[model samples]
Target: MSLLLAAPILIPLTAAVLCVLAWRHRTLQRGISIAGAAGLLASAVALFQQVSASGPVASQMGNWPAPFGITLVADTLACIMLLINGFLAVCIVLFSLGGIGQRREAGGYHALVHGMLAAVSGAFVTGDIFNLYVWFEVMLMASFVLMTLGGQRGQLEGATKYVTLSLISSMLFLSGVGVLYAVTGTLNMADLAVKFAAVENSALAVSLGLLFFVSFGIKAAVFPMFFWLPASYQTPPPVIAALFAGLLSKVGIYAIIRTFTLIFSHEPQMVYTIMLAVSGLTMVIGVFGAAVQTEIRRILAFHSVSQIGYMLMGLAVTGAAVADGLPGGSVAAGASASASTSAVNAAIPEFAVMALAGTVLFLVHHAIVKTNLFLVGGIVLKLRGTTVLARLGDLYLTRPWLAVLFMVTAMSLAGVPVATGFWAKLVLVRAGLAGGEWIIVAAALGTGVLTLYSMTKIWSEAFWKVTPDAADLAAAGQHPTDEAIDAADIGPRGVPIMMTVVAVMAVATVALGVLAGPCYRVAERAARELLEPQAYIRAVLGPTAGRPASASEPAPAAASAGGVPSQR
Candidate 1:
């Protein structure tokens, strides 16, 4: 348990600190980074073991009890998230060996990566709401530096938009936190869970919840707030882009789920309805955006937003189902008074379970698969020395393995069967039908098909077509600017073998589909834990942890799913 808590946060922080202390020694910095990443992986595995045995572990910082001080909690979900993130860090570190080494100031890049890892891990483990905010800032700061690491014109331009939007989002989030603290007078999550119950249906609480929703929505790239992502994410180096794709947006989703289930569960109808509406629009807009993009990374970036919509759909239905009532029990007892009992009986229609499972499974699978795609793209650009669809050509003959890998990744993105993507969409669609939400079900299916279309467009343009064979391209009459052709020479080409190895490992990510059943069962248990939260509360506040520090009664579990009707 100690290793689980310490390794993810400390291993990375220690490495970053060491690198800073030995900034002049590039070799030493590399050694520290690799060792730290390796230790982080070991710690993740160890944490998984502890979670498997103990259910969940909570460590109060400095040995103070949960509500009074800070605590780091690791549940099955947290452990699994850590494992995926650790694996990504390891692969990206390996990928960075040659690329980051070429840069003049490697120390800062390496240090920032480590710091970013620590921040991400901290966000996952921390039990205090304010702590989550701290970690968000840390991670964003690292991302800004990494995005601009190349010091190129495009990167600087993109980073400017990225930082501006991210800063604004952070300010919004901080302001939300201030309002929440002002209302509840507690920042610790479990402690607030208790306090929030007392104020469940209050206008103040609902308003605060919306503030967080907007703030996290921006970070998560959900719908209206997603404009900044496609513009900035495409400009970073492959390793950094892959890291951002795999982990950064997830933190936003995690925050939403955590707050919805624990704090805002009081208002299921309003929250879930809004989520459903936004999700539908997000899917439509994101895929439509992808349809128009010719750039490889930009298309993938749009798909990220689309996929987030799918993940949220399940939760919206889950909230609706839970609101409809638990299977046969005293409504009052089942309310806030017996949260654990109600949670167990919630019976999230098999489809909902399947959908939620797929969502989590997809999150893990997408992280690996997406990273692999970016790395493979990097390799293609390396050999051809160009990423532009109009200028680049003939990678199929030059790098067969890379071409094949790209095909598999693109197909998986298209949600073809036997791939992890198939199962994700399948479950999501099934859940919508089970909830009698036929329109949502149809929307999800349409998104999958559109996803396929977008993917195939990229495949045909970048891989299948013969480039430089175009009459217009070679014609002297065309007199196309020489600068367009010279832009291809801006970077190195020739896919390195190490990168190819990194890309190939995505096959394992696909294999998770074969093992989906057990994973789903595990996800169910985790979901149950999330919904009940008694164990979490006990872990944080202790059996005798008593009431919230504030003077409000536990919000009554309203008979309806809109979390206990707003306490008047």
Candidate 2:
């Protein structure tokens, strides 16, 4: 069981080391990268199956007990995330083989890719807050290197902004950890949860919670904090951008969900209200931003922010249910009641479950679809030689299959019927209406309309319009770079490697949409575990994990306490 839990992190780290060692041999490095990705995928699948059959799984390093040693855990949510990461790693590695230019490959690109994968896997599985912080740093370091690999002017500029913002987020996270430790004196998340519940200082706890909220909000690319994403994501290679779009921000969302649900399950009213307001603003701003962008990758980057709003909506609903004393648990003590609270409380559990399940469903569906869309953009760049909409056209005539693939993924993104995104949106909208969250429902619907509009703009400019000649491009003050010209001259033989990887993802997107039932069942189970985290708590800290300290009782000393020590 421990091996299964460790496999996802270990495989990637080992592969990264091997890739670095074989850096002088590009062929060996490439082979190692492929093998590592495949190994990760296999390990993730096994872990998911084991967790499914036998509740949540946990392992303490060096045979040490919980709260005293490093711990790795795999609840349903973590397993689902690991599975997605594994799949993306494979597709992105293959895509990079064909899409990343030779200059970047020679600069330890494969090694960096594996390192990032290791960090992502570690983040998903670790049970300690400080361990999560370490993994975030690892991910940030690898991504910074990858972003600046080619040293192009645009790449360097983007990396500077990315690194600057990311470092700030890391510092805030560490500071939050410090403050939280002062209040609770534990770095283990399960242990912290018990201690936080017993703390007497409401103001201090709330302040620390907000600190985490701000730190993760920046990483999740929530509205008002998402400007850095659009400015920088478009500048990286499309494969890197796709991976970032699909996985990076989602990790932040994962952290938000985990902390809110498992650790800060108390004080639902404040948490839910904040999440709801931020989600609405995020959706509105992201779609509006996408509407105005002409570059393909930039538009997609903005859409990533919008999609995050939907996931956050699910989380907000979950918080509301808890506040209303729904099926998952009770409202926090001293929570003030309002006149309409009774009415809202009447329909809590059903809608809350729907919202959470919808979020999981949407998360998986969007990751596959969004990643495919970016890969398609890379294909466009490969054939048309640039991503500027006005400078390129007529892809439908030249490559109808690519156009069809784009239409499928784009429509799926827009939540068109029979597409996976449509069902995801439907569930959330229904949940919102059921809970009387009219503003959220309206924001969701409005965002979908604008998303379709943006997709149509891309379709019209890049596929329907005639391809601009060199003279026309020069007239418009748009000169294709020498690399772009060379890319355009390449024929069908140049596309097969990239095309195969994209086709697989496209098929998976359709499969998820067409076969939503089975996937929703899995998501439903994951949501159940999230909403009621006893299984997760026990897995990390043993059966006695939930025992809280009495108000008059002092906490156990840190060195002697078993699992989570109670608050003093």
TM-scores, all models, native as reference: 0.89, 0.92
Q: Which is the leading candidate under lDDT?
A: 2
Root-mean-square deviation (CA) per prediction? 5.9, 4.3
Best by TM-score: 2
Write down the TM-score for model 2: 0.92
lDDT of 2 by residue, 20-57 (tens): 89979998999999999999999999999999998898
Candidate 2's error at 3, in angstroms?
1.0
- List lDDT for all candidates, in order: 0.72, 0.82
Candidate 1: count the clashes. Answer: 11
> Could you tell me the lDDT of residue 82 within candidate 2?
97
